[model samples]
Target: MSIEQRIHAHYAGLSPQERRAADLILDHIDDLALYSSAELAEMSGVSRATLSRLYRHLGFGSFTELRETARTLRQQGVPLGPDGDPELSQHLDQELRNLRKVLDPAGDDRTARAVSDLAGARTVLVVGLRNSHPVALHLKQQLQQAREGVRLAPLPGQTLGEELVDVGPGDVVVLLGFRRRPSGFERLVSFCAQTGARTLLIADGTARRHASSVDLWIECPLGSVGPFDSYAAAMSLVAVLADGVLAAAGEDGRRRVSRTAEVYAELDELDLR
Candidate 1:
């Protein structure tokens, strides 16, 4: 069993002091590998002996064993928290690293090809689920400004089957599939393939499993100092991709954008204030 499971199993049997330490351990489970027993004891406001007893009760032979177990969990893509509270500078550094990987020049050819597909397709469908929805919506909005025939899937209460019914040749499907994707995501990709629609997958490392199935895959790094995954790089890539599509459309795209602005002004659709 995992360290967490062990802790819960023996939680009721722990002494008051051991329970205190256990509570602290549970709160910082992600950072367990980074803390020494002494540091944990200090942070938990308990004696070192209490920490020792707590680990023992958790089925760890020693503190080192406990830490190693936490490390292994982290390596398996578990969203582990930082050793301690992270500063703004640390968060910025991680975001910069992610952007560097996403904007790397080595993948210029891939980006160019994706842009060409989006630019030439007769219809473009942007799909995103869960945390990926906003990005998909934003990409669809941007693409629409560049040209017509752009739409977002699963609009509010709708299902993907309805949106995908007409997707086929001369169509491009942009799928934003980040981590924590639903079980049926792979089947969605397969369905797109069966319909003869060109597919582009923009996702984090977890989507590498499906990379081979799609026509194009753009991987974005989402490591963050905190527990939650960051999407700064993914958002930046969307901007770059939208710009590429706009450039590919040339004067036609410019005219469409101008006309869109004119309509928005006529309808007072935007709140500039």
Candidate 2:
């Protein structure tokens, strides 16, 4: 079992002070590997002996063993925080590398095919869950400016079935599936297939297994120097896809954008100041 599992299994038996330390460790689990026993004890307002006892209760023979377990989890791609804060230059270099993969010329053909479907589809549904939601929503907003049929799926307090039930041939479903996707994600893809809707999947490397199942797949590298996955490349890809859709839309897209600007002016909706 992992450190987290061990903590939970023995949590009820821990002394009050040990529980305090355990709680602190759980709260910052991602950074657990980066913290020394002394740092954790000081931050948790617990004695070093309490922290040592907590480690033993959590099934770790020593604080070093606990840290080694956390490091092992990190090596298995658990998104543990880096050993030290990354320098700005290092972060920039990593972002640039990710952007290069996203903007690679080899993927242009696949992108064009996706844009063609988005431009021509009778209905377009953009779906995302968890971290992918913001990217999907942004893409939906951009697509709406280009065409009339764009829609966002599973709106607040909604479920996918309600939006996907009506999808069929001539419709397009764009799925933004980053890492840590829900277990049912593959099932949703299969359902879209059953509806005969064209599917476009934009995801990080973790979703590669599902690539062959979709009509088109765009891989966005999300490597980051910090604990959380970076979405800069994903967002850049959204911009590129939106631009392609606008261009493919021809004069119609231009007219829609113009009309939207007019409405904004008429309602005084935008804060120009």
Candidate 3:
């Protein structure tokens, strides 16, 4: 197993100091991988000697191996945090860190573009099965606020394709899928291609089987909690995407969110009579 995989496997079981070491490595991934143990230890307010012990405990022969691993991860363009390298923990410092990276100025353009597409699209249909459903629903809520003409599929009797077929050339279909891959989602994407609809796939990595059907992609880390995956980063991405749509909507966006509240409140206040 990779150092990261090992770290995660035993993450919860790690003592405070060991976690401190892991946190340090996680906090400054590129730097740690690029520098020596002494350099990395200094950054974490810890001692080099202590870091050396931690490295050995994790089964690395030397700091050189650790550095090599970090370098390899860097080349892979993988972000080091809870999503890419999660540990079993109640807190989600990694997600906040990852969110900051995603919200970086460089990443804002893509967010803006995605939002604009949703706002302008004739229809917006979403797909997410398994753990991705929450993220998909969050997007649906935000887009409902960002602008109208949004829909979520696989609800009630409607299948994902049932919604996919309805999107015309200017419409958008956002599919949320990841991990171990799903052939059925890919086929659904293929069906979307036959339609005139524009497509977007929000995924976790460079894997592109389902990415082929979409015109754009948003990649984020999939955080996990124990056997369960963390959807924090995915939710954050949904937030960012929604912000973009809200930006595009101007006054109309504000009104939509406000109106949604009014309607929901009315529903809640009613006796169902």
Candidate 4:
């Protein structure tokens, strides 16, 4: 049986103290990922020994077993992993797998959807701060090339607000913000909620809003490329998304972008030896 169901079946039988422990466990399975039995106990306010006992009563052979069960349950629907930096550079295989799972789920439909959202957008605003900013700017550049009204605001304060104030229904906000909390991403998302703009956030972990709340969410594995979290997987996601949109924007957007490129207006024409 599932951890939840097993716990719930014995719910009426649990003593008040056990119930308290149960409540804590149920609400915070993910936090348990980082906790030892003692740490879990401290957070749950149950004694470490009692916490172990409570999980035992729930049918786990050990605390690790309980944690693993909870982990599996939490990840059932989402495509992701533990919250860590992309710059860590330790887990390329894991990151690649995560990217594939998310992008290939339903055969690149997610990427296609991201593009469709762009093709339909009247204005597109992309936001990210700190280690995440450059990726957001990269996405904005792609959208601009597709002839969308795309703008990326500098981090912090009213500059972001002014950008968001312009978003309305039929607009898309593609936000990239992750662990350690990217400044201003959450507040912008909340503001957009009121404006009725569509929001798509790329963040870390399984939480829909790892750094900030958003409408559509894609979870990218954190990695490291030297000091920066490896955005390899994140970059792959954006590349695929841009390709999908560029392809979906059809003859009109294609013609417009092609004209600009052909005339070398913003497009540069340089000969290389």
Candidate 2: the clashing residue pairs are none
Q: Whole-model Cα lDDT per candidate?
A: 0.89, 0.88, 0.71, 0.70
Q: Which portions of model 1 miss their true places by more than 4 Å? A: 1-5, 14-20, 36-85
Q: Which digits, one per residue and each the tens of the lDDT, describe model 3 over residues 1-273?
A: 777677777778766777898887766654455466776776667777777777887778888988888656643444433333335354467566556665677554766677777878988988777556777888897788778788887787766656665677888888787554455766777777677787778876634556656777777765433234456777878887888888888998888878877887878964555
TM-score of each: 0.84, 0.77, 0.61, 0.59
Residue runs of model 4 more than 4 Å from their true location after superposition: 1-92, 106-109, 155-158, 206-213, 224-228, 263-273
lDDT of 4 by residue, 1-273 (tens): 977788899889887878898887677543455567777677778777777678778888898898777556444332233444444344666566766766667664556666778778888888877667878888877777776588887645655666776778988888776665545555666876678888787876743643345567777766432233456788777787777777777887689688767777454574533
The prediction achieving the highest TM-score against the true structure is: 1
lDDT of 4: 0.70
Error of 2 at 235 (Å): 0.6
Stretches off by above 4 angstroms in model 2 are 7-79, 106-108
Which of the two candidates, 2 or 4, achieves a greater TM-score against the reference?
2
Judged by whole-model lDDT over C-alpha atoms, candidate 2 comes out at: 0.88
What is the RMSD of candidate 2?
Answer: 5.3
Error of 1 at 87 (Å): 2.1
Q: Which of 1 and 4 is ahead in lDDT?
A: 1
Error of 4 at 179 (Å): 1.5
